[model samples]
Target chain A: MPKGPGEKRQWQFLERMLLIRRFEETVVKMATDGHFRGHYHLYIGQEGTGVPAIAALKRKDFLATTHRNHGHILARGADPGAGLAEILGRATGLNGGRGGTIHLCEPKLGFLSTSGVVGGCISLAVGGGYACAQRRDGSVTMALFGDGALEEGVSYEALNIAALWHLPVIFMCENNSAGAMGMAKGGYPSLVHASKNLLLIPKSMGIKSVRVDGVDAAAVHAATTRAISLCRSGRGPVFIEAMTPRWAGSDPLWPELATGITDLRMATGGAVPTGKHQAWFEHYDPVLRLARELANGGEESVHRLSALDEATRKRIADAADFALASPLPAPETALNHVFVQEASA
Target chain B: MSKQSYAAALVDALHDAMRSDPRVSIIGGYVLGLGPQRTLTDRLKQDFPDRVFDPPTSEAGNAAVGVGASMAGMRPFVDLGTASFSYLAWSQLTNEAAVAHYMTNGRLTAPVTFHMLHGVRGGGAAQHSQSPHAMLWNAPGLEIVAPSTAADAYGLIRTALASPNPTMLVSHAKLLGIETEVSEKKSAIPFGVADIKRRGRDVTVVATSLMVPYCLTAAEALAKDGIEVELVDPRTLVPLDEKTIIESVSRTGRLVVVDECPLRGGIASEIAATVAERGFKHLKAPIVRVTRPDTPVPFSLPLENFVTPDPEKIAAAVRGALKAG
Candidate 1:
């Protein structure tokens, strides 16, 4: 470990960014391998948005996110293997594999909940922040959503309440210009104006706003640290917009050919990098940016990335193995977990 | 024991639950409604200023907020106002809160209590009145409990607050004014347990929500003839105490599901289907369902009355089931 505080923190950012990158990679692979029995939305290009935002928070702070949450969970210290195992529907997975990709919740790690509904968790963070405000627990909540969520009235409802009450919530929107495939097969260009002008909506509601370059992890961390400071000082209910792009470029179709997937990879087999979007992801990746930044420190940073990459890959592999070996849930226990007592039963 | 209306009981339950747990939050079109209902969250807001809130008339947003708070460790008793209006917030209530626990592999629990006023009251036609529990019940991860009495409301509301499952506590709007004497001591109504409001041998009349009281009335009328009526109230719908219902059906050898929702695939159908599937051999006649017509709740009072499953209609359905037997 590096001795200087700044150096140590910088390395932490690099490690987290890499882990997020790899976790998404493994998830794309798992989806390819048919490990996910349900629908999954990949978080490939959005690592820079979530990793640093979560890094700025304390463990007690709550993170309520949208469906694209793999990056958010990984950034919040969820074991990648466990996360993989979870998506694989194994009992040992993060949500016992029940949440799959879209509805994952790891409350112990302060990852409150994720919803497939676009604007689902925006107002939810407001409620969580309300609890934090009443308790004076010094815990703030972050609502991480994509550009499409802004179109939904829930975001406005959430911001209005958060602002009205001065709740300790940081409304974080990662504008990826993405929409549901059910609605838009390609990216939603109509959402561009909304994404660009999103900061104004929160501002009109009386919540303070800050804009940041989400492509750079350190910049995101610095922005979030400032936001967190403002929140802790009782100047909260802040809105931060990270204008970032998805690494899979414009169309983030799955890698699976049979499932309308394109420009993605399988879990076990490495992708040869065919599509233009894949090449772009390889070239302008945020994790790569952070790694390259860390590598600026010369041999030490180089050696660390080398070791971390190998360890993370092994961790993901072990997770896949564990998930593969884990038993499917018992048919009789289907009634189990309908209620909490039933879970015990 | 003191006499209290169902609405007052709900208000009292809200007060009691909020007092007991600091995490209880109430939000939505949830006005404490009538003067009596106002006593619930109004006082709650005064005491826990930050916890009790009335967000913009946005049910989808409000639903998300409640679920989020519950997920983050708060027991949100959300008054979605009318059950019919829940259609506006269906995506969150159904796709989010309802499916959260099961989808999360049971690691996450949404303990939010959705207090929705259900059934067709005169003038509440169409959007203003609907019993969506049958629709909501189709979802796997939620508990839908409709209480017909003041005691049932108090007990079930308390249970919903204490419960870790996402619960829809549908209190019949018509039952709001109906008063009953209830013990001041807290009533703890466990989910999935059927209450045998009235027991008889010839036929079983399983009713829900306000229909319970009506069925009791019909049971009285049916007693004039040789037909004896057994009445059961499955207070909590999702954790349906099917065992109790099946047993009652086996003894009676006849079953009729009385509900206020639409006839097509509502609670009545679910109950009838459950009994038909599990207790087939016990049936002496085809399982009958006396529910509101598939048509939307009509605006005219006469049309509404004609469509609603009243005591007369229930008696007719029972007689029809008896004739079939």
Candidate 2:
């Protein structure tokens, strides 16, 4: 099954990517089936950025994410059952049912916060950087946000502070709009901003900034590795803008599986790309692209990938069942965590 | 016991907290704003240079830094300068810091103490003169401490620093010079405990922050006119000592809530509502509120005074409540 020297790393990346993909798909299915309420953003096409970027972080490094945070959390190795339970407001959820979809975070896993406020995580991560600086333990903080977050006033303030303080933070902006949005039809665009280039926003503060292809996992991993090393050396607060085309499902105000469920076989010879989503399958889909890369090792590699996909599907299915079976938080326990209680004698 | 100025007690509290815990750190420029208090903070900075930070004047961003630092095991003391300027940080303080513990369902804690100088101070105009504690009280999961004495300031600031929840330490510029006997042996006072500044039986005067001093003067004046006033200073707003206030009202059968906020939807309104809701039978007369008028504090001295509550206003409110029923 292992053809190349780095085949293990390749399979690991593919497995994490598949986990995020199927977890988000299950989220959509559960939402459609009336298991949860409220609007939720999907991290479908941007898996390449989150998986690779997070993989580069050390165990001590802190991370803060935005509304499109499900992929980032899963990439950090959070339990899917707990994540889905949190979305369902169950007592066994990650946050004990308090922080649902948008705020699904695990502080134990070095997550500072998952802010529902557009650019809120950016500023919070700066504080995390300050904490790392105080500890002087070689830890860094990463702020994972979308292009729309750059339009917020707090972003400028946070970026300027990070630069002045030389705080160890990596500002990763995932630009899924890909410059094709705001056209005559077919797509929704990022919020309008005067800056022609989002990178300039951080560059203006004298911050070291770079741009990368969001669909290329290797490129993102390289950029994040370099950024983390720089931050750990105290020459930090780097900015990376990863560009990806908006997923067709993310076009409407609410997320819809416009491409249907991703067909991994389309990467192998068994299936063929067709219809309006042909361009997405060919280039933009990070999961399929990685699958196709692994399948390039011939028939044995394809069989291994197929088995991996089936196991991943089963795991997500079990997570969905666990979330569905988990009980909702007790009505009287709403006031439990409002204030931190002192331990009893 | 030694005489300590309100400002000195506050500075000492911060020093004690930093010395007691390695994780306690201070953030902001000129903690108490530009004044003699700056000298005290300058000393603090010299003592703990590594623990103190003077960030740019991004109120919301700085407050968020405190929230973020707290989440990372640092107990941050963030100063928002003036209560008016705190409006800029309302979102960070209310949305992020205050909600961190509750939203995370005990998985996280933001033990941040936000300090601000609130209330009217002479000719400080509309933007400079504001008491936003009432508005802040509306947001759940935040501990609001408004100490009325040098001793209370020394005691409450320590408790605020030690709290596991986000806390707001509301101070007053006008009360800085006021001196009271503060014992060095006193420990951190627990929250949700009310202090009776003066004992009387005719009316219960509930005051906060600078209003406590004004109400003290009013109580003295009323005592001379054959009326006794019992004064209750609720140290913390979020975990309010309703029992103390209600018991005082039960004895006096009259309540006069004096606060520096606007009359409409102010701290006085909330206290009055609480009394009416739970202590209705104890109140023999309708409750009266002595507060700043619902208007932008004018720049002119007389116009500002006309809207601000003072000793005369508190005394008048007590007399009015006494005669109401």
Candidate 3:
């Protein structure tokens, strides 16, 4: 049975992508339901950039992302329940509840960390890459950020250092046109932010750069594979501008934060909110489009993909349950883990 | 033990650390020629080419990457040029690196030693002159250390390299050239332990960094006046050796703090407060602090000298603490 519409491996890839979508969908619900608190940036629409691009990375390879990090975490194989538990500030979470949505990390799994600040994780990626080069770990570090990060001077510094050292890093920019703040109500055509092309900037720095349609998971995987190969062979520190679109249409949480709870129902209960941009998101939606492609492989491929979505949905439900049931960190342990907390056994 | 300049001691430690562990390295704007026309790091750079890094000019980026390297199992001595430049990387330093271990629940630890030269070095005024030890002292996760002697600079830096937590060492620019006998052999100077340089019963003078030597000088001059001043150097500020300071105060029943940092919210203030809280009953007089005024360091030598706490100021504070109450 073929996994995705194209390659047999792609179906599993699609499953991972859909699972991330399911996870993000669940996160929005949980965040709204009061299971999670504090400022949260959902990795909803930009799943294409995180999943396939991060999926290409192995266990030893480090993956760093921005505040919108769930997709990157899960695509790197972070347990859905544990991630949710962390977001819910549970003692059993990845960061033992100290790190909420913005700072999820599982170093053992090569997902070093996520930074709330824009372009913050870039230097970490460079540093990780530098360490890997020193150790000759035969591993790579990929830094994923948005077009918004390009505006940050530190991002350029990170890129320049990466290029100067030829560090084994893939600078992946998920170009959602505008960030969570500058979401064009229409689409990229209507996006007003005068964002510079990420490719041209890196190219000017003599860094090997590439661009690919991020919505196509297979395309993303193919491009990332080439980039990683270059990094592995030592002619590296590549820049990849994946034209990834965010289906969020508009800032979901801000409106809820502004209008109170009345606007929550539009996105809840799996209701597809009405709008031209929403329709565009639906048509261009990676999952739906991938399913449409899988439909070419007859009903069986489509069924398998749907089954993946359903199983992932169920898995996300269990994650929510785990998040809700897990205990908040003990009050007495507030000062714990400031330094590497040694094993108590 | 051979006498070493503060510069030589730092280089000796860096060489020892890099030689001892392959993971030990230095990252900064320029490690070579860090002081005067020549530097200890410049020598280390020639020796361990890969370990010593001259990164592009970006304090925030350099700090982030340095911390990242630390997390990736390297003991990186990240020097952010002058102490004032730390202001540029304040966000990353305080928020990201300092809080990393606590925030990540100890799954990740950055053993990065951030080095910055503080205090007013003559013409090095305003932007160049800033004693940020006070700033780093208040940050909980970051262990703060300021070495007045060449031995401690060598010993403490090595200790910081070995530490699992983030550490910031603020070396006074003036102390770098001062020659002093270090350990005969390699030694690790543990943090949170005060070194009692001179013992006297008249009054206990607590000091830090450059002020330690100034306090010692003050003690000598005051001793001529038949005023015996016991001086204490709380080498590390964060894991402050409050016990030693308190015990010293308990013995003397009087306290005066000499600090190169500002008067308000400086290490002296903290020391004064600590002695007051823990050893108030032991006090025979009010705590006095000889510190720079809470203002930007001026460029002119006269103005700078006036603001900076010197032997005269330290001696005056001792007399004040003894005479009052």
Candidate 4:
């Protein structure tokens, strides 16, 4: 059943997706400007996966994502401003500036945690599922990972255990078709074929599996609703393969080369905007699609977006200011939190 | 109070903890009688069937699950069968459970107890027999406990389970059958406290885990030779009882550390460094360490005996320290 056409929910989703996209773009600029430290994996083109997957979850449901987790964090209701502060290494960040982008967490929003290591959070979500099942709690655990993490052995192990124990977990695989520059050609024969293989692995292990058009938010929400229902009825450990594409060009060279090809404007070539090249981007600019839908509905939708955009921008600005003004962790604290110290004297 | 073996005492401690707290749970392979060494999990399952879980054979997954359960406010005792098997779950123990409290800035607490049977067990061979005390002890966030007696076993394991942070109890397989008089009532033993099993004035013998009893036996033989030996058991390796070891060495004027791990970068080396730094003025001689050679433990009985630290080696180390003093 469609969640009533509430402008509030639509605006909320649009604002979050836009915030994530803009924040990531800003961070990329910051990286270029030498203001940001460490390598950042941007979720620019894949905002659809997070928007839809998280829109289907309740406030009590928990989420654990991989290193490419900014979109997921924002989708699960973390303030984009705090997330930006974290990436900026500010104290106002979700992890108190201790964990940068790679380890962002907002437990208050049921964002359990994120791990830098690929496929590391799979078993953690399974554990969370077990906890939920043991307590007979209706809360579900969504473990989000990229297509690259499928190569890890622990992922398979976690699926097997989750299936055997009948835990309440939703394993959502966002197949971005590349594992940090290794394209599908060099990695797998095809993204969909590989996803089919993954789906089979989980199904054979007794988990219910599904494949959805991840670009379509409604499709993702429907699939998630079904998965959540099955889980609540004590029939889960479900796997969903969301066939999606990288929004930005996978490598910097590809975009540069594409621009050069268009610049040549040969006789056979036609003038098209740089944005319309990728079919995935054209059909699934998640934020744009939601905004267009909301505008078509009525003037109230536009009003909601305008108000939300202002509020979100202000929140992000405030967080950035707070983080920039905060102090860096002390040198001695570098080793702190690696382990829990004894209770203070 | 009845006499109890080290393994039995551990089982009793688990039972007592389960009876006292409803949140305590167990998960691991053969942890519920799927394997031969069914003593630990068998007793647990028999007494507390609901809490003692027979997890699938995925050490990494189970360990991570234990960390999750612990973070969710459950006291989970994860049995990894052997310390060497812990390498598979090293990421979970090191990155997740150990750091969760600090990473979340004290908002998260992982009260998970990792129980492993470490050290050489008969002819278990390379993969199964290796001691990983030094490996775990090096990790900052984890509380590493290695008890050498039934009393300390019950006390330390109970205390670790009660702790709000991640703790690991590495029990030696060889010490499983060693019987000792243990009280029926369970009690908590404070971490970082050393137990003086035997007292003397000539030299201080600092030992850990299975080597503690061997040190005491060696001390008896040294006393027969009119060489007074003091034996110290550092029940917890991470928050080491450096004060007790230093005080004992200060009184005895000599120090000898016996460890089952290899000589290079072992706990013995750390203890020796501690003595050199704190008790250097009181030391009548250089601090000596009796430990296995820097090599993989051999399968042959005589070769294993030669490589592992035993009573003979402890006695010889004491004589050498006395001579040097």
Candidate 5:
């Protein structure tokens, strides 16, 4: 169902998701081509969750993300070229090529940054929210993490503090079913069970909690809108569990290779393959579903999407060229920036 | 002259820093209460309520918030009620504050001052009491300061507030009420530089924080016995004043390091290793260290005292070094 009184926002949400999807697809291809060297945790299957969650945020609000944070970075309004260039390790990147994909940050845009360590950003976001509340800046902070981060003690501690202090922090959990190779069901008893457990856990700690169907962009957007409104009105620390799935194959594709030949054949065998109770790509591809929905909307929407895809592709290519041309950091420069200099005369 | 305690000296330091730099802010728990050493927050809050923040009982979150404020160009003095509580904030101090500059390759800086109160205080048992200087000293890219005197506490704290790197000032709860004539100047006692508390030629006794007073007492006692001993106070640990330590050891050819931290991989061990490696040829005796045994500080007064390095221990270690010499 469409969210009432925010038709324009729905379109904006779709645009942001499209941007993230196109950008990530381009990044996957670049990584495959060896242009991007470091570990890239693509937010391919989970763009719907991030796009709408970010839509709930004001421009001045702050956010922090985990290693898999390309969607959050884009939603926070970082220049796509700068983000792409950073991931590619270019001088023109957000952190001047110093921080690659795992550490992409745009502080000016209120995106505090990303840390490769799981659940580390949770406390940082709580702190940021506390600072904002102390300053009475009316800005909320969103901490975006994966299901893998829930097990970390720091995340729990952060949530407790945020709740106790009534910090304007939104804990956005992107439950994408897997942490690397471990399935949610195998690692956690069950994703649905874990989600329910988390819901009561936050409420018991005096935090407001919600669960949303992350695959449905509109549902994610509606939950975010409510959470953000409550936070802005001085009634939060809120918890959101976006039950999304990993629609695309994990980046690098090398890890999937180890899953066995049968699985691989089933995954890539057909365009819209339907077998004995085994629905194929048609049921799992997030981008394909989005494209089909847009195509059904009108010929004009399809044309606009194609233009967006072309622009995003060109931007990615240009970023790759820029990154390739940039020089690697000098060995001597390694010791630099360990400490800031005392303010001078 | 009016008498005052060590805690009062720290409050004075906080007051002096706030008077000098408008940007300086203090955040901690029970800082606004009339607890033992009065309250650093109570006095500052009366004077500058906006600057002195009494945060909730969230040590890690508050520390990280202080870090964030520092990143936003504010000089924040974060107080972890006790040294034991600092363990909860290790990740923030080590990961974010310490590594921000290096990770960003000089693009960002977190100039946060963490003030932690530690050391055995009466019957304050295992959970409440712990000397965590060793744990903090192990973390690279952080400036660790432990001042024994009120004057140094005032001076060094002023300097740490102005520093661009993440700094930790571990104050001993036992030393808070001691009074000394602190200078009004806002001068910095440079980090990694050791002070010669007492001059002697027979041997060099290196001490830190609360151990400095014990070493001084030991030096005086040894002086009466005609065993002249020098006392060296290494106010800062990280930028360890290796030059001063080596110079003193080279001249005396004997060394005794008194550290409150446990023996295993403690700051004393680091100092001893540095001297042994650098001043090996000049050494007339093996370097000895007087520190707590490799175990947690206990609750019993006698046991805790025995566990902590004292003047008698330093004096004995000095005599042993002299005998070896």
Candidate 6:
């Protein structure tokens, strides 16, 4: 069996990351093809932060994420077919087509909520911490949010409460603003906070704070594992700020495949990328970076990585087909679950 | 039977719930009330030292915490102090808690209870005095309970605590000191049930929350003037007892609605619209509503009194309804 980073387990990480990368690509294609309506966020570039971080969580541990939550759900082992169906607003979706893209969640796998509102998941995860404390189990809650969430006022309140109570919560902030183009430049909005460093916000509240490179999957995994251990031991809450350079595809107002579909051959040196977005394929692409790391072993590793990508692509394509075939919810059932009658049952 | 203040009854209900259910906990320090009610909260904190939490002034955050905790196994009762302050927590209450179950496609439920002391209490002014329960009623999926008497307070709060859906238990600060007989063994009161405070023949006066007691007093005054009135108090606003109100209107052709909320799009407006739509054939005269004028509650005591609906105002509305027929 393979061992260590860029080995067997890292290959599994590569598999999960590939699933997310491919799933995101399919979502963009479906949206562009007019299969769905309304604006939806893409998890294209943040796979490094989500995959490794979520892998550190146990089955019983609770998680709450933000609008860009498709990768988080898939990383937690949610079936891509159900996830894609939910995004397509089909009856077989994870939330029965009611939640759609923004509110997609899997409660059975211990996801508390995938809030559409920014800064909404922080307090919810703190609550999960309180529940875990009450159970006296080793379970912990992880709040995965973007850097923009720090600007909202509730984050301050929630961070303070977690520190005071010493709750078992890991506040994982995926700060993707290092190379992000702001709305002023026709891209998504960047973090707007007075503090020079984001980590100071949590540290000021007496929370144990740390920073890590989000693009480095190994570093992210190590940081997340340490944070979860600190939380499990009742060391209050830990605030992790993972700094990542925003992908070129996310530079525009709406996400576009600027660098085009990943070739996977570029990581094995059979092909090369040469364009304005060449830097993305060279450095920022987490999928290519991990693949290149594994392929560095030998030519055998190259064929193995390519084969793994082929299988992941096939699985995602099948999931998309399943979602496309799923039926829309019946019209007469619109008013169901409005209120829980006889809730005790 | 035991005589207890309305506030005391609410405290007792919470105390009993926490004692019986270990998963039930209270947030936001002391529950807002007078003298003995505050003492009861103190005792509650002492008994459940680990459960009660006194977080800093963070309505939005703590409200969301209650929502999150409720979904994750614990039932939390978040005290939001004054009704006006609920504005800070409006998003958490309306967006997150109210829509969780439906949005999640029945995969999750937020069994959280929010307590707020509502309505005008003397010189509470614009910031302190408010009855936003009507606004919350506009948001679907929330169970709104506003009790008018001590016994109703005891029974209704228990039901709210036991409910699996998010519940808003609105208590009027003005009604706290009022005392009435409450059975020690009284069970939980079901929602959507209206209690007829007084039965009469001429006019049906539908009131809610603080307006119920004023309407009852007006019913007695109207009786002396040979204008018999049937007073209906809707215990819960969301699942309103429309059947009882419609049946009462059937008995008495004249209808009068009274409420402490403002006249524009208030509780009175909703009840009047319901009657006009569903029970239109039974009406002999145009319905009259005694409600607070569409203005911010003034700081001056006399201005506050001038704007708010009182017993005399309700009595005049009932007599006018009878005369207009």
DockQ of 6: 0.57
Highest lDDT, which number? 2
Q: Place model 5 in a CAPRI quality band.
A: acceptable
Mind giving the per-residue lDDT tens digits that candidate 4 earns over B1-325? 7787787787778888888988887786453222334656576777877677777778888888887777666788999877778899888888887777776655567788998888877676678777887877777788999999888999998888888888988888888878877777757898888899888989888888889888888888888989988888889986787889999988999999898888889889988998899889999988898887888877888887778888988899888888884
Ranking by lDDT: 2, 6, 3, 1, 4, 5
Q: Mind sharing the TM-score for model 3?
A: 0.92
Q: B54-79 in candidate 2: lDDT tens per residue?
A: 88988888888888888888899999
Per-residue error for B15 in candidate 1, Å, reads 1.6
Q: Docking quality tier of candidate 4?
A: medium
Q: Is 1 or 5 the stronger prediction by DockQ?
A: 1
On lDDT, the stronger of 4 and 5 is 4
Question: lDDT tens digits, residues B1-325, model 1?
Answer: 9888887788778878888888787785464355345555566667767667767766766777788778877888777877887887788788878776776666777888887788886688788788888898888778888888889888988989998878887877788888877986857787778899987998998988899999988989999886789999989887888889999999999999999888887888888888999999999999899988889888998998988999999999999998996
The whole-model lDDT of each prediction reads 0.76, 0.89, 0.78, 0.75, 0.73, 0.87
- State the number of backbone clashes in model 5: 7
Q: What fraction of the true interface does each of the listed models get right, in terms of native contacts kept?
A: 0.62, 0.62, 0.65, 0.44, 0.37, 0.63
Each candidate: RMSD: 4.9, 2.0, 4.1, 4.5, 4.9, 1.9
User: Model 3: what is its DockQ?
Assistant: 0.50
User: What is candidate 2's local distance difference test score?
Assistant: 0.89
Candidate 2 local lDDT, residue A49: 91
Give the per-residue lDDT of model 4 (tens digit) for A1-345: 233775566666667777776666556655666665776676665676778788888877777787778888877777776787787776567777777878887777765546676767787788777767766669788888877677776777788888888889999988776433444444222234345466787878878999887766667778988998898788997899887655544444222122121111111122333554544323555555565566665555556556666675676666566656766655665555554554410
Runs in model 4 with CA error above 4 Å? A1-3, A6-8, A178-196, A253-281, A298-307, A338-345, B29-40
Candidate 2: TM of chain A? Answer: 0.95
**Angstrom error at residue A310, model 1:** 4.6
TM-score for each model: 0.88, 0.97, 0.92, 0.91, 0.85, 0.97
For model 5, residues B151-209, the per-residue Cα lDDT tens digits are 78877888889888889998877777666555555356777678899899999988878
What would the per-residue lDDT of candidate 2 be over residues A46-98, giving only the tens digit for each residue? Answer: 99999999999989989999888999999999999999999999999998898
Query: Rank by DockQ, descending?
Result: 6, 2, 4, 3, 1, 5
TM-score of chain A of each: 0.86, 0.95, 0.86, 0.82, 0.82, 0.96
